[model samples]
Target: EDSIVPAAMYEPLVKAFGDAKNQVSLFKDIVLKLPRDNRATLLLMIDFIILVATNQGNQMDMSGMVTALSSCLLRPPRHLQERISAASNVFAIIMFFATNRGTFFAPEVSSLTQFLPPDDPALHQPYSNDKAEQPQQTQQTLQTLQTQQTQQPQQPQQSQPK
Candidate 1:
């Protein structure tokens, strides 16, 4: 039961990861925004997909895995017309995540932060499409700082008296 994603979160998740060029960053954002249990469940699901696709590449590639899991993963748009129009986009989003799992799920950066309280000043307001770059930018800045620290010149230590 812990592995099951709640049906209620499906719609909002789809909307949060709405179509755009930078789906991997959006994928990372959605994963981090999830409640603790849900976040664990989703990460497990993605790992499973990657495992299956990798082990059975001849039998099931990323697109094939996405097709197999689409019903389980995606919540269709409510209106009939909307569902018809949105099906491909829904698949595309999932496909993009699957194909670029390395970028979105990089081991060094993939850990989810503990959930923040609703009123926590640090929690970002719900992300908008335009603000999708924020997470990626933050990540880049972190990497740059880490690189600078590692590459900083070590000052020569004066000889210590015995």
Candidate 2:
């Protein structure tokens, strides 16, 4: 069944997904029909996400990375979302290496970043509380200095006694 499924069924789905005209709707259908335990489903999801991310500004709309991330998050079952999130991290690391080598790993890093949530502490660390508050603290100090300057009365020079 596995052999037949990939060769016969999955190939057609992949081909349909590759088509620009109806790829999004077709991918949705394929996702709905995919067997829950099938690894191909995961692969197909990744491929479709990459396709949409890369094709933005051409046949597809790139918009931002958040759209792709949101689509994956909206998929049924928390397990699948977690799997895709892990896959995204792996892809990010791989692409970073590829980019440093002056090679293109994929054309969708920006979109991927957009899809990732800010609260994902594993993705990006938050500033320390003290560090985060430093800007506001500095602004307040500047305001205090300005107020002190305004409140101080300038002393009048005494008239010279003849």
Clash counts per candidate, in order, are 0, 5
Best by lDDT: 1
Report the number of the highest-TM-score candidate: 1
Candidate 2 C-alpha error for residue 144, in Å: 62
How far residue 25's Cα lies from its native spot in candidate 1, in Å, is 3.6
Query: Candidate 2 residues 105-159, lDDT tens each?
Result: 1244332232234575533743253877888999999999999999999999999
Model 2's alpha-carbon lDDT is 0.43
Give candidate 1's TM-score. Answer: 0.48
Off by over 4 Å in 2: 1-5, 39-162
The whole-model C-alpha lDDT of candidate 1 against the native structure comes to 0.60
lDDT of 1 by residue, 56-151 (tens): 436887777777776566554455326323357556656766777666565553333234455755445552446779889999999999999999
